[model samples]
Target: MSCWDTIADYGLRSLGYGERLLPRSDFTLCQQVVLIGSGMLWNIYFGTLALIAGFVMATAVAMGKAARNPVIAKISAWFIFIFRGSPLFIQFFFAYFLFLSLKNAVPFFTVLTSAWAGALVVLFLNTAAYSGEIFYGALQSVPKGEAEAADAYGFGGWKKFRKITWPTMLRLAWPAYTNEAIFLFHATTLVFFSGFPAQSQRGDALYYANYFADKTFNPFVPYPVLAGYFILLTLVIIGLFGLINRRLNRHLPQERRSRMQMRMPVLR
Candidate 1:
């Protein structure tokens, strides 16, 4: 089959639309590319949904942290500390076990044992905490003059915060937010590792890459193909986030505003 045919046949195979069975023997580069590209859909799903959802939660956590109220501030602080202090790998393991135990304790908790529900929960919380910390620092640096300027314009409380404080915080927090976004994408590889079974042999890019490596006793081909796919994914993510960063910094001087630049990839 032509490469286009191979891709079309298996591109969305993870959702079970194409070839009924994966290539078992005589694994070719065509099979690997098609299957792994199909797996990329799952990575994009997890990363995009988690990051978009986490954006709001992170803002709330950061705003709560910067609030004058001690109780609200403390809760935000502790949540951020708890998630940030530990390795996400440990968190995923612990979360899986905790969900498993919860299922044992309460029969109604089976949903948490399902990877779709459980892994998303873990990632949602994890990214929220990390992004919250980034935003909190940015909020703190929003400048007293900006706050006073809000007051001078007869703005107070939520109005001042919603308009001035939030925008500025986002502007200052954006580069780091982009970092959090990329980190979250890398973290998507951990979904199957965290007790979330790949139902029906359906797995993410890494999971399939690992499978090929094991079956063929060849890591060189499969792993590097996975890497190339991920590099492409990363570039796309940067391009998307770069648009947002531009909008966020639109009002600032070019030299002072942060541009989205590639940095070290964060592997979970």
Candidate 2:
């Protein structure tokens, strides 16, 4: 096939369109790019959904962790500790088996064996834990003076939190939150590697990249393409977050607004 024909055939292959079987031998640059790019759809879906859903839960979790009630605080702390203290790779395995065990009793959980449901849930919970910790620290760091001022005007309870607390916490947490988001996107690469089945080879960017590498016995080509795709994805994330960061700090003077920087997670 010509380059354009190859692109047309495999462009959306990851979504089960156009090409049915992947190139088995004599891989070309066009095949590598098209197939890998198609695979990116899963990564984007996993990351975007997890981040959106995780943000809401993370906010609640942060509040719970910061609550005056010791029981609430302990529950939140335990959740965070369990998810964060262990590696996410382990979480996927444990969660999959946990779901498997529950599936016999709760048939609804049978779907968890698939990367779509199970891996997404794991990523959602994992990101929520990481982002929750960031939000919790920001919540605690909310200026006491802001609280006192709200109190002077009789703001308290939900009123004080809604009007005076949440926005400030978001503004403060956003930078680190952005970092967490980038890391979470990077983490999506790990999903197929976990116990969850990719099912028909429909997988994320790294999955197809790995497939090509294995088939061609040439890591140099496919891996760099994968890396380039991720770099672009990272830049897109930074741009989107930069817009939000701008809005978060809109009220502050330019000098006071924090600049957004793309940072990689520190691996141990």
Candidate 3:
């Protein structure tokens, strides 16, 4: 079959619409790309939803930690520290079990049993903690000069923060936020590995890729396919973030604004 045919036959296989079963024999490059690309839908679903949800929560946590009150600040600080300090793998496992146990106390909350809900929740919190720290750091690093300028313009409290502090934090943290986003996309692979089972084998890209490798006993094909897909996804993310960073910096003279740069995340 042509690559297009393979894709047409299996592109929506994860949702069980095309081909009742995945290709069991005669694996071709077309089949690998089609199947893995199909599986990427789930990864994108999780990553995109979690990212949108996480950013709002992250900003709140960062602002809370940056607050003047010691009580709220300390709690937010501990939250960021603990989540950032722990391995995401462990967090997934722990979250899955905690959700499982929740069945006893709240049987109606069955959403926790599914990867869509359970995994997304964990991912949201995980990204929030990481992003929270980045925002907090940016908050601290917001220049005193900006605040002084805002004061001269009679912008104080809510006005000062709205006009300056928030935007500056976003700009400073954009690069790190990009890294967080890339890692979160990659991290979606761990959903099936953790306690949340892949119902009907409807798994993420890594999950199906692993399936193909094990069935054929050839890691070379499926693994590289996954890596390529993820790399491409990362590039798309880079471009999107770059666009946003440019818009964020649009107000400044070209020299005064920092250039957006990519850095490999050491933590991940």
Q: Top model by lDDT, which number?
A: 2
For residue 209, model 1's alpha carbon misses the true position, in angstroms, by 0.3
For model 3, the local distance difference test gives: 0.88
* Maximum-TM-score candidate: 2
- Encode model 1's per-residue lDDT on 82-140: one tens digit a residue: 99999888888898889889998898778978777788888999999999988999989
> Where is model 1 poorest over a 10-residue stretch in terms of lDDT?
259-268
TM-scores across all candidates?
0.93, 0.96, 0.95
| Candidate 2 Cα deviation (angstroms), residue 80 | 0.3
lDDT of 3 by residue, 1-268 (tens): 7887787888988766777777889989888888888889999999999999999999999999998999999999999988898888898888888877887899965788788898898899989998999899999999999889999988888888887999999998899899999998989988888888888777888888999999999999999999999999999999999999999999999898778777666646
Model 1 ranges off by over 4 Å: 105-107, 253-256, 261-268
- For model 2 the local lDDT of residue 54 reads 97
The clash count of every prediction, one per candidate, is 0, 0, 0
Residue 255, candidate 2: how far off, in angstroms?
2.2
- TM-score computed on alpha carbons, candidate 1: 0.93
Residues 1-268, candidate 2, lDDT per residue (tens digit)?
7989998898888878897888998888989998999999999999999999999999999999988999999999999999899999999889888998999998899888778889999999999999999999999999999999999999889999898999999998888888898899999999989888777888889999999999989999999999999999999999999999998889999898878755545621
Ranking by TM-score: 2, 3, 1
Score each candidate by Cα lDDT. Answer: 0.86, 0.90, 0.88
Q: How much does candidate 2 score in TM-score?
A: 0.96
